[model samples]
Target: MADPIKDTRRMIAEMQPRLHPGKYVFCSGIRDDLAADVANVAKGSFVEDEGMSFIIPQEETDRLGIAGGVAMRQITLMVRSALDGVGLTAAVSSALATHGIPANIVAAARHDHVFVPADRAEEALAILLARQAEAQVGS
Candidate 1:
């Protein structure tokens, strides 16, 4: 993988956003009995006051009998952005918000994933593409 991008403009300019297939929903599980199941199934998770908030496949919610809200789709930013990179999330969210789309971002080892309402996934991808195009010119 290439060096993680640090410059905001360059990061945006090179970010090739691609939609990840399938729908995902957040589920909460904190019981000791649930740890293995969650660790095996959750695509990602974050600790929350109520429980362990897990982003798992929508199907798992049904299987696990857990309540989930707002089906979301992931848009993976191909740029390998530094974990401490500045402004990338703000730029992404700002661009999406301008079009009335909400973005929930997760930064992993190699890329940043943006989760948008499933219904707006395609539109969000387009907006990111346009933002990247504009940034390319600026870079």
Candidate 2:
């Protein structure tokens, strides 16, 4: 694997944001046999006092009998960013927010995943690409 990027500009310049297909939703209170099949495939999940919160595919909601509200799309940052990388998230989120797009960032070991509303996904991806280009030019 490549060394994780730390420079804010470099990280943004190379974070090739790829918008994934399909819609997803955030739900909670799922902790039963019905959830077994979808558990491993969840884009993100966490355990809270109320229940198990999950960012799952919208299609899975039907079989799980959960309300899949607010369809979203996942955009994976292709740049390998260090866990402590500064400014990358802020820069990306700010760019999207400026255009009235809400972003939920999930930072993992390899890269950062962004979830944005499905309807606005194309616009969000375009914004991120523009940000990347701007960073590249600045570099």
Candidate 3:
């Protein structure tokens, strides 16, 4: 099997994700302190099978006084890694951070999802593309 981290460059395309930044929200049935507290809903249900759970930015969450909450943003790249390694996350995060882009990483069994701010979507794509190119050239 190909290494998840090493093979990611070939598995996914570098995309310039377009974002329509507006009011939005999502809910996870499984609530935990680690998850963002955007809003509290007494009704409705969430699907836990979906690898990561997060509520997008919504007016209700604002009204509920959620803090440390991140606004809905764009994800320039979607990558999958069968190998769940902490080292890969840190390395990828460090690469993005070096370019002054904040990456919110969520790891699922089959892949790792990275969410970047809508405003920085273009720059984020450039960074990832460059990284992919570098990997290609090096190999």
Quick one: best lDDT, which candidate? 2
Q: In candidate 1, where is summed lDDT lowest over 10 consecutive residues?
A: 26-35
Superposed by TM-score, candidate 3 places the C-alpha of residue 65 at a distance from the truth, in angstroms, of: 8.7
For each candidate in turn, the TM-score is 0.92, 0.93, 0.53
Give the clash total for candidate 1.
0
Model 2 ranges off by over 4 Å: 31-33
Writing each residue's lDDT as its tens digit, candidate 1 over 27-102 gives 6754677678766999998888786788988888777666778999999999999988899899999999999998
Judged by lDDT against the true structure, how good is candidate 3?
A: 0.52
Candidate 3, poorest ten consecutive residues by summed lDDT: 37-46
Which of the predicted structures, 2 or 3, would earn the higher lDDT when compared with the native? 2
- What is the C-alpha lDDT profile of model 2 across 1-139, one tens digit per residue? 7899999999999999999999999987675876776687687888788877889889888867877788999999999999998999999899999999999998888999999999999999999999999999997
lDDT of 3 by residue, 22-119 (tens): 53334444345634443244212235676444555556555555442455454423444545433555655777899888887656555555667656
Instruction: List residue ranges in candidate 1 displaced over 4 A.
Output: 29-35
